[model samples]
Target: MKPARPWFSAGPTAKRPGWSLAGLPTDLLGRGIRAPEVVERFAYALRLTREVLQVPDDYVACYLPASDTGAVEAALWAMLGQRPVQVVAFENFGLTWAADVRDHLKLDPEVIEAPWGELPDLSRVDPAKDVVFPWNGTTSGVRVPNADFISNEREGLSICDATSAAFAMPLDWPKLDVTTFSFQKALGGEAGIGVAVLSPRAVARLDTYRAPWPIPKVLRLQDGKGFDRALATGTMINTFSVMTIEDWIDALEWAQGIGGLETLIARTDANFAALSDWVERTDWIDFLAVRPEIRSTTSVCLKFTDPRVTGLPAEDQRAFVKRFKDLLEDEGAVFDMEPHRNAPPGLRLWCGCTVERADVEAATPWLDWAFGEALR
Candidate 1:
């Protein structure tokens, strides 16, 4: 039988168990942005974010526009170039951040890179140089296994794009200076907003250092004075959707009510374990991240190992993967399971907090069936 709940998108995944449009708070709708009630709504979301993520009290979680990319860009443009910056690129989004530093920001960074499914030799990273990397390789399904490579006494900053890691993983906040993510990913919330948790060192960088370039108003967060406390504390410098904020608040409430961070992590772990067990028993599929430890527990990516498809030319391989995607999609047994445009021919599934373990287990049989029919 087809899966009971068949969604597997890597982002904007299935909503919480009892989520409903009517259940979301709507009293703040049509209220003024700076009004006390609306401000309280945003403040409540921020409080739950810090509590759910277990972020340190000193770090400021600022809500920014443009989603995860926006939060990353704000830090890159405003704080990079003060010292030697090292950009670590592995997956697509990691490569995107590296590009922003190299091409867009026009800075020559010490780039540490690896192929899509592998991580770089992180031990080679300089302790004294400012560094940037992703906590999770969203598209490639690789993640930094730990933060032991980062030095606790480094003089430079550590900027991490944690867009796909926040709700599902444990982060070493002390080792990180700037971290960015969105509620849209693991929490199944609305898109278009990003939250950045900045360390005291990161705030100091903003206050003391200059970017040597013109900063846009939308991305700008600091001035000659210091960090913008108003924005960092949930006040919007730009016009924002109250609907989005309400959705974010609702997601956090769901997460908190379900036992907070540990429960969220446990749910994702169960989902990943269910999916991983299938990949192990199946003969035709294998994880893209060969190193099991570094394999993402949230965005689990896999490639077909069957020679029927793998032996084809590169373009033909892509065509066959597309066929597999279409076969499953047409069956309504899966959705958004195709590999990203920049990734190799493969399947990506969301095993996040919002996804039930049984749903992931249910998907495996359909996946095998789809692959067999596609081969036929």
Candidate 2:
């Protein structure tokens, strides 16, 4: 039997298990962003963010434009260049940050990099240099197991691109200097906005140092006298959609109703367990992440392992992936299961909190059926 709801897109991902377009609040749809109630909604969203994510009391959480990409770029533009830098690139987004560091920022950072399925040697990266890395490798199904690599005593800050991990996994808040995430992923909220959390040290950096190049208003963190503290408290740096804010509030309310982070992580883990059980039973497929410990529970990427499939030429392998996913789509067994364009030709299944474990269990047989059909 096919799963009733088959949304598996990694981003702008599956909505909450019971979500309905008609259920989204529209009372403030066309209201001004700065109107008192709209502003309060924004503040409430931030508060819910901190409470549900268990963000540290001292860190300042602010809303920014352009989703997770904007939040990461804003941090890069506003905070880097005060000292030496390092980038741990194991996936596309991290690599993009590395590019910005080298090509755009024009800074020769110590680039600690690895291929898609592996992580860079954390021990090799200098602790005293400002470092940037993704907590969860959204594209490759690899993730840092924990913050054990971060040192408590270090001169520089830890900038984390936590876009995909925020609500699904535990974040070691104290060790992270600047952390950013999109509500679209883990929370199943609308896109086009992101939340950035700044440790006191990061805010101090904003107040003390200035970027050599002119920072765009959207990316700028501070002015001459002091940091833009108002943004930290709920003021947005740019015009925002109140309708999106309501959607965010809806998601946050659902998260809170379910008993918060522990529940969210449990839900994600349950979905992961269902899919992993299927993978173990199937001989033709295996996780893309080489190490079991680092395998992502959210975006579970897989590659075919059968000799005949693996023996296919690179282009053919890609074509096979397309045909397989297309078959599933046509059958309504899955949607958006194709690997990222930059990632290796494989399958990337979303097992995020919003996904029900039963759906994942119901969907795995489709992968087997599609593989056989595509082979024929």
Candidate 3:
């Protein structure tokens, strides 16, 4: 059945009711650093995150540029010049990172890839080698096995792109050397800032692995004494978005007040369970991710099954996309259910904690309505 209205779409997901662009503090131009209080507040916020996540004192949390891509690139440039990079690909973003390793970084990477719906084999990972992969493939709604797959005694660093997973799920930091995330995901912070958390091992790797290529201004982590640990608070780079930093602080406060990361995880889990229940009862729809265990709790993906109405014909597929999108938007039930441009045509909904469970419950019927209308 088509949704009576379509109401769910994967990010930039939904905004919190009181979320406002104006709530952000100014001094994003880096002027905030001049004031000790401002800088202290920022650092304190970062410290709070570390405490909440149970990050060891040896681990440092730094504010990278505004985007998660920036954080990932910074870590790669600083820590990758020595080891042979192994990139694991299960979805579009992972493939993109792998490409960056090849074309931009110009490193010949050993790539282990799986199709969109599947996950890369964790057993194939050699803990002795440097590895890079996304924790959650937001576009495809597939998640990799946690850091438990990587042995603690591995020789190389494990860099994780967890933009969509941070705050929404638990990250096994003991097994992760370098983890990067954007504020936009579960935090619901505006775009432009990325958070990079690194363990002592990761810092050591950066200090030892001097890049063959010239490190750009933003990516370099060393300053004479080798990888300066202090850079984690000040961020080795220049010019930060103070406003974005404060936005992250606000998100962090909300997280703590609402029972922290565990609460957020439960919310997402509940949303996914709700969505899963609905999917089970629906005949025409099925999950793209074959294994329920690996399915992403944050991004719930689906496809229509009633081929009798809109299948087998390419024209019908195109029509289904248009009608489903239009129906959801028109009814205010959901937005942005269309598949990623690069992925198979299917629906992807963000069941993140920032979104209300009531909204998801309210949206299921809209999905049925949308399907019914499209089929008609």
Query: How displaced is residue 281 in candidate 1, in Å?
Result: 0.6
**Model 1 lDDT tens row, 58-90:** 899898889999999999999999898898889
Model 1 clashes, total count: 0
Provide the overall lDDT of each model, using Cα atoms, as 2-decimal numbers: 0.89, 0.90, 0.78
- Model number with the top lDDT: 2
lDDT of 3 by residue, 114-152 (tens): 998899888888887899989998888888756778888
Q: Cα RMSD (Å) between model 1 and the true structure?
A: 1.1
TM-score of each: 0.98, 0.98, 0.91
Model 2 clashing residue pairs (backbone): none
Which parts of model 3 have CA positions greater than 4 angstroms off? 1-9, 17-33, 234-236, 308-319
Model 1, position 362, has a per-residue lDDT of 84
What lDDT is obtained when candidate 1 is compared to the true structure? 0.89
Measured by TM-score, how close is model 1 to the native structure? 0.98
Model 2, 147-220: lDDT tens per residue? 88888897888999998888999899888999999978987888999888999999998888888988889987
